[model samples]
Target chain A: MQPLEKTGNILPLLHEIRHALEDLLATGQTMVIDLQAMPFAPSELVELKEILGVGEVSAELHALGKSTIQETAFSGAWWIVHFNIDEKMISQTIEICHIPAILMAQHADIQMGLQQLSSTLGGVSL
Target chain B: MNQLSLEERLRLHGVSRRGFLKFCAATASLMALSPAMIPRIAAALENAKRPSVIWLSFQECTGCTESITRSHSPSLESLIFDAISLDYHHTLQVASGDAAEHAREQAMKDNWGKYILVVDGSIPLGNKGFSTIAGISNVDMLIETAKGAAAIVAVGSCAAFGGLPKANPNPTGAVSIDMIIKDKPIINVPGCPPIPVVMTGVLAHFLTFGTLPELDHLKRPKAFYGQNIHDRCYRRPFYERGQFAETFDDEGAKKGWCLFKLGCKGPTTYNACATTKWNGGVSFPIESGHGCLGCSEPNFWDAGSFYAPLSTPIGHVAQNAGYALAAGALAGAAIGFANKQKSSQAIEKHEEITVNDLIKGETK
Candidate 1:
């Protein structure tokens, strides 16, 4: 809760992530940067996000968990942070890709939703 | 001859104003300039004339040219290079023989004291026949070509530092361009074929500002060579934590540990490979899991085994310092006598010797 205290240097990590984004931009492949392993305070996370800066676009997902995904100023880069039911910080990662995979609706969920919509329409006789 | 400015060329090539501004921003960051300089860079580049560049290659493998020209696809970097009036380049020039020589002579004459002279490879001074362009010896050709140039860009380790050709013993008596041309303001871009973008970046800086960029002690553009690879390396965190890959196939290596123990010369070497990367910023040598060979440093070939640690002494030494001291003391009188005899022999061998004779040790 106190801005996650940073025990390790973050500049080198950011440098690596920048290069990973470069690869993603060129290859159209996605790169995931796992920040869960590092000891990062919530404060430090906030500071890092500020340093990364935000893009115009952002999205939120509420399926398996409450996830906030946002793009950075650098093209093809995204930061995703997950929160548990208690709203405590659980995991954080930076993804470099055209579009974040977490935002994609699962095929099974889409099919199930379609079937439910059809059943509702049938009952309503519309 | 009049040519379209860089901005005009970009417009002709369908690069939008927004795209040009983006490039300016990227270049500004690349040169370590603040974002505020973006507008200034854009303005400079917009009206910048494509200067005449004369490229000269001596005793090199053509890797430098290949790195700058062929590394990336036909991108903005290549487009800028193409936009320049490259008057002379043996490998790339279509003219051959007398026609090539005539073209070089004409370019020098036309852009007298105005053209940029970019040189790759070391100059061999062992003999006139060691290396030559057309009928002129390497040193002769270099001196002649350099006379009328405004500024010289020594582009690659060979031209900047003598490189492999100037290694210990130096069979061809190889020397860098600086050794020959002292009058010209020389900017060295030292790397065994420097990063493609670094080479282009230096050119862009020159085109933007009609003077050379700020230089380091080694005369390399400070923007690119200012930081050591070790300082910017991603594995530096591992190194700080006292983690290192002891061997190529070790667990640490597999886990992407620091390559310091595996003879990464990144600590001593200065270049932008770690940050800018290679092959479209995809991955540099360190990212590919190999230690830096420190190709950007001078005399890297004679620096010692690439596999050896930085802490290891480069030269062989006596097993015991005490024994070496004792041996030196024991042989002192004999060495003095031998020196006297050698001096007498030198006097007897040459009737009248000049400075050149002393330099070449040509008494006999």
Candidate 2:
């Protein structure tokens, strides 16, 4: 069945992302939009992805689950989809930022790594 | 047993910051909060300690438990269920007989006045022998257990509102939790069997924020119950365009036109069915080519015919709409215009749906 256009949430979300991109440029702000918050008309999500297209940067993180981080065609817009160990998609989001926060190493993990390195080399820990 | 915060537990489980962020993002969405609040949810979750939950089941068919059990592992709902201390549950617990009672008593003693009490099924007040566990009446057990609870979560329509057992000719004199316990803060998760995500969402909110989420007049979480199904329905366009399916096997039905004429109660019923869906994102009743049974609302079984469309008079435009609105709302439904209307207001809002409307096949 075709969407009647009167009850469409996809276009409004695209507009919201555009506004978020502008906000990012003006104030150095970042934004995350939860794609699963609202129900989508069938195939609307696929249509959205097609519209955004794909960008060069795409990476996968293996933590408790497999998380795919890909930049959309729009430079600052990133699409991140996470799957549980069982391969179930837990969450999907669109983030507008310079670099998505999850891609960076956490400070606590870095500190622990540094301490382990110092102990391994018999050197003073910073 | 691990006296650690939720973050600490996830870290020990080898979950990284990224995984935790994914969890938070999913959780925020499930709780109907914006994605911007993920950081706050994460921060709050760092210090959030797991509270003990005591699940009490009575006068139930175990559909609520079945709904929760159907939830897959590692989903936020199942994850939170694992995170919390589910001290006593009759269906899942290993202990039985006196041993089971002992486990319940021990959990209550350990976390007295701080533990969460989750009760499913209605309480039969007429006959003490109507429903009992280990020679103890359901009402007695509920009253006794409620005394020390931090908050009470009435799960499913049976416990939240009087469900099937409390339908016409209700022999057991079954009444809801709110009717019995007025002292404690009760959060009603009403559905024939509530969506498992919503049940866990309430628990997640309590775990993260140390308080219950905002509730509507029916004591349901506004996040899930705030919008009626019609508003969120994909068939809404067909409904607004006045293109309705006249019969179950008609041309309009094949083309996926609105099912209002087929007695779909989507317009009157309020729940997260359209958005949350059921059986893990599979289609809901309306999507499956069936009218909503209005199961979540009170006295749904007695609210005229499920096959009868919500009647309206074509003669009076304003009068017919108000009458239709009040007819649904009178049963304590969250119909769009009059969810807050009093009984007197509902009576005043009522207008007649004459036989001529039916004769013309023009019921609204």
Candidate 3:
């Protein structure tokens, strides 16, 4: 049997993830996301967090209580986002469900805005 | 018209000629002075009158006194109490009650502006009632004693930087002698318990010169506190090569690599521990495979976690990564282009020369 191709376009999923990340960054709040049981590698999780403008990413080895994401996946695939201000973890399930194209565009715009802000404040590019 | 010889002078002070000369030699070596200075030291000491000194114990553990008392060679007790006229030390004085107070009072009255004052602890000022000795608050006692002192030597971290008790929250509001007595020239011999040799060296310098030695901004003698422990560290080569011990007994640690990753504070600590070492220059903490805790620097306790590595990005990774990649790519393209040019040139040269002409050239 032919391997089943991923049914939905990944661009829309990425856009949704990007919007959630932007909101989290702006508000400095923790967010829970569902990945819809899609399996992904560690590198994909790292790339997803980077693309979503998460600064420093660390992974936990255990599930946070009562979350919808599997304990193993949460421990293995969840990414902790770091900034000078704070650190927060993002669930792997949420990442897989929302890899949308508009999210990539928003990520670029946010990165550019961050660069401008850093340059203005520090008098040097970050 | 009779002046005693150097031997006679030393004998009058109860030091044998051999003992006096040996002490001169030791002093010369300790001060990093030329051997020729030994005779001068002997001569100076022979003619020199014993300087009056007043020992004050404030809010402290008496560890400084204990450390000094234990000096193995030419013990500090003999040097300060018997060798020089230590007029008053609350712990050492034979006088008691009113008599002890009278001795201090009389010493100050007679030697006003000439006696050396040695303080051994921080003065707690949070409340005037925090610490008292002999019915006098330490702050008030310190201020009163420091008034007529020719010079002040704060003998430990307690009297130098308020020490462990002043670490954080600082509820007692302890302060060093410099904070209270700004008018007098103060020399700080600071350590958990300062090196015995350092304590003697400062006193020797004063005894020989009748003044304080050159001091740093922190009022420390430059001779001992000038260089950072890392500058003279044996593991410095390992640090330079990026070899570090991840944990206490790990493989890297077994090989004696840098302890920086193990939370060594050598980088920021300035002290003579590495060079001078402890226990008569025998060994330092780093030599025994422990990272320096930077106990000598001010506010070291509050700096941060002691075991955390002073994290800095490794290599030129952040600065030259792009340049290196670009250079590699350019080098690859240049080599490809050169190979293409060489092959094309060979083809053109082969096409231009007939086989017969090539054979003719070889034959010729």
Best by DockQ: 2
**Which residue runs does candidate 1 get wrong by more than 4 Å?**
A1-126, B318-364
Give the per-residue lDDT of model 3 (tens digit) for A1-126: 212212232456576655655765577433334331222221344455455443233232211111122212222123321111011211123432222111223343456568788889898554
Please state the error at residue B161 of candidate 3 in Å. Answer: 1.3
What is the C-alpha lDDT profile of model 1 across B32-102, one tens digit per residue? 56545767998898888889999999999999999987644445465557657899999999999999999
- What is candidate 1's TM-score against the reference? 0.69
Q: Which of 1 and 2 is ahead in TM-score?
A: 2
Docking class of 2: acceptable
Candidate 1: what lDDT? 0.79
Structure candidate 1, residue pairs in collision: A3-A42, A3-A43, A4-A41, A4-A42, A4-A43, A5-A41
Deviation from native of the Cα of residue B144 in model 3, angstroms = 0.5
Taking the tens digit of each residue's C-alpha lDDT, what string does model 2 give over B246-265?
Answer: 99998788777889998888
What's the true lDDT of residue A76 in model 1? 78
For each candidate, the DockQ is 0.03, 0.41, 0.00
Clashing pairs in 2: none
> By DockQ, is 1 or 3 better?
1
Kindly indicate the candidate among 1 and 2 with the higher DockQ: 2
- Residue B81 shift from truth in candidate 2, angstroms: 1.6
Off by over 4 Å in 3: A1-126, B1-9, B12-19, B34-36, B72-77, B311-364
* Residue B66 lDDT, candidate 3, scale 0-100: 85
Docking category for candidate 1? incorrect
